[model samples]
Target: MRSITRFITTSDIVRIALGWSAFGALLLATPLLSPPVPAPLLITALVSIVAVILVCAFGVVRQAEALARRLGDPYGSLVLTLSIVLIEVVLISAVMLGPGEHATIARDSVMAVSMIILNLVIGLALLLGGIRHRGLAHNRTGTSAYLAMLVVLIALAFGLPALIGQDGAYTTAQAIPVVIVTLALYGFFLFRQMGAQADDFTEIDERLTLRAITSTEPDAAAPGIRDVLREHRTEILTRLGLLVVTVIPIVLLSHDMAALLDDGLARLGAPTALAGVLIAAIVFLPESITAIRAALGGEVQRVINLCHGALVSTVGLTIPAVLIIGMPTGQAVILAETLPDLMLLTVTLLLSISTFAAKRVTAMHGAVHLALFAIYTIVLFS
Candidate 1:
């Protein structure tokens, strides 16, 4: 009872209450949305739903962070990345399944998420950390592991399909092997991350920063991952339960938001891909704040995990889920990016590798990433 009381706070109740209220309100409004509606009314409803979804998402991340604090690196960061990606997957699925045809929804969301997290969030993190501490240090071994997996996954998901297919989509036969391979690889990566390679994902102290970054090998000490389940079983269970409860309304409301987004964008004659950007933004905004905060505190490794780790999961998990969904529903999901977008992604990946290769990253690296993001934005809007 005492633990329960400490766990439940006023803000917690309010966030959940607002989530369910929006869910109920919009559930009733779903029918009206099917018909032609006033533009003002349509925009208002969407704004309301987007706002509430973000609130609940913050609550979800809040609980996940609480769990992360107890669990520590690797597992803690894994928990956070998975939670955000789950939101991304759910929103993409909702939009795909909801209203109009959105063949490129999956591709666009993955690309938008990659560009935004990799460039925008990361750029800001590096800039701030650089200014505050002259530069910030990150665990390069773990970052390299993440980037290697990411490079292959991104190439597989975005590049290969465009080269091989007619409309940047796979033949059913090709998709099967791709999905199988992608998940199999991700599963193996997770296995390594959780076991012997856990220390690779953690921060390096100033005294040990050089060896930690340049060793190109795991530490001989082999600091194994903490068995948090054994150590903090009760608190972990409590947070997991709260996380689920907070996530439910966001999941439910995503359908309503999807419908509104499709309708709103169609009305505005907005780019179809803009819906994907918005979905990525909605899911990522809160977590981006956390990443910057970590950067401010000189936790560059955490920022890498949040930003780099997110794109890895975004490509690793989202592509497979999109394929799985597309096959069954006959949605004909498009996984290939356009040539221009492809170029930007390639540059972004290579730049990230250079930025984190050194003992520390400074504003110079961040500025370049931000400039790239600006170019991506111009292409997106123009």
Candidate 2:
């Protein structure tokens, strides 16, 4: 009874109430946002609402991470990835249907996420991890495989569309075949990840090579099996409940947030691409934190899986979703890339090949990636 009581605190109830209150605010404000509220007040209101939504998003990430810890690898990362992707899809769909009818939101946002994860986040992770530990090792086969798939998908989804399609934007007919092939490939990758090659994503520990390492020391105190099970069961249930509760408000509030975001970005005279980049940053925040911690903790393989897996999932799942919705509705799905952006992407992929070419990650490799990331950032803002 005491433990159960501890799980449901007054503070928790108050937070849930506040979340619902925010939802109510969304209902009242979104419909009336037209004619552009006075710039000052509009910006203020938009910033405040975004702040609240980000707080809610952070809560969801915390709970999701807790659930991940309880569940362990592959399943853990899978949960986090799916949750974020759902939010991304919701935001994109809402924006597409908005007054602006954002045709390029999906493409720009997915590209932004891929760049942030592949360059900014991964580069920082490896740079810091390398500086701290000199170098870290991960399963090369898994890392290389992830890089290979990433290159292929990026080319087929982003590159080929520009080369063969109408001004780089795929017509409905062009999109259909691309969607089918991408989905099929993703399905195959998922099976391999969860089944036959599951171990590939983990670190290869040399300690397991010796018989002495497998032998338990007599002086070591062993934990009780039942206690471990009970703890895990309790944690899983509690965190799962929190995850459900937190994610509900995110989905409920995201539509209004998307509407306001478009209004705000346009009002500020921001670049069109900036809108997608900002949205991608908000969505990727949780995973970015997780990847950083993993790298710092010397868990290079987990970092690879999280960063690389996110890019794969973002493209694999997101492009397909966009095409599926856009094609049927006669909505224009713009995926054309500027020549400079395409060049940046090409160089980034090449760096990835070099980074994962070996069994270990080094500071030099990290430095090179970070240099490319710096160039990408400069190009983005300049």
Candidate 3:
């Protein structure tokens, strides 16, 4: 037992490596294996896709926990955002390139993304955080700013596309310009986020000091920049390495998962919109677990930052990437015309109202969110 615990085994690394390797193989095989299978057989494909996502989710959570321990919240936020965007990009790209089954596929996808983040991600995070901390306190300024940015970005990337589709003026030529400008704007935002301008937009939670799980003490009067860099060099490298290792497998698994989802959805007659929702779930699973942990540990600020920050990142970064990529391909991803967007809009507004009204969440709130999630599922199938 002692030997097993203390020594590193080649078999363990092999197992980890094989899991990812198999995923890569599957991704490569999927396009080649375009044999028209029966709808019932697609069930197996769906299960396999879900399994890949589960493995991806588990790996992400473990790596994110390690990152959170070392780099504090800002860097951790970057990790979460990158993972979600990568998955979204992969899934969207695959669906757009695949059979042109759903005309409003992109619209459904964007709506599904919004619903999953607001109704499921934010809802569950707040609920779990509330239950853990009783009455949690987060940075109101950060939350409000994030919400405003999310609304604007979503309106631009998703809402405008839907409206354009309705006007029947969303030509491939027009789409090319839209995508170019959108990508440029996203690039600018990303640069600002990682540059000196970050300080102007970002606000550190006061409550972060109150719940210092593994963060270093804020040295307002302490060392020089050189001293700080030298002291944390090893830690920074380790965190970066962890993130890189985690992201490689995540990308591989996501690629395979995308192919499997296409096969499964085609086989099962499932709505393609559900694809975005599934991708959102997989991407958010790790962050959701972290949010629950922070809430339980009385780190409400962390929960809020994670939940809202991820939502904003998904909208701002991922949607733009999809639009930019899909526009050139002649894939006009639009919202579903079957149901009023008003219903989804109302749910999101209700969730925001509930979250802000009390500034806390509880098990009851979780139940409510779960109920809404159930309603969403029902609507999808119906």
TM-score of each: 0.88, 0.82, 0.73
lDDT of each: 0.81, 0.74, 0.59
Best by TM-score: 1
**lDDT (Cα, tens digit) per residue for candidate 3, span 1-382:** 4433332234434435655676666667666546564555456655664565566556556656665555555455666667666666666666667776545555555566567766776666666666665665555555565666666665665555546654422456655666666566656755755554444333345455556656676546534334544776665554445445555564556544655576667667997656656765665666777766766776665665677667666555555555565566655555323434546556665576566556455657666776787788878776
Arrange candidates by lDDT, descending. Answer: 1, 2, 3
Error of 2 at 281 (Å): 0.4
Error of 1 at 168 (Å): 1.8
Q: Pick the candidate with the highest lDDT.
A: 1
| Model 2 poorest ten-residue lDDT run | 219-228
Which of 2 and 3 is the better model by TM-score? Answer: 2
Question: By TM-score, highest first, what's the ranking?
Answer: 1, 2, 3
Better of 1 and 2 by lDDT: 1
Model 3, residue 15: C-alpha shift (Å)? 6.4
> 1-382, model 1: which lDDT tens digit per residue?
7876678788888998898888888878778877476788887887788788878877877887787677877777777677767766777776677778988877777888888898999999889888888888788899999889989999999999999865989888889999999999988888988888878888878868667777788867633345558766777777777776776677667645765787788887877667767766766765687788778888888888888878888888888888888888888888888899999999998998888888888988989999999998788877
Candidate 3: regions farther than 4 A off: 1-16, 27-49, 94-105, 162-230, 258-272, 326-339
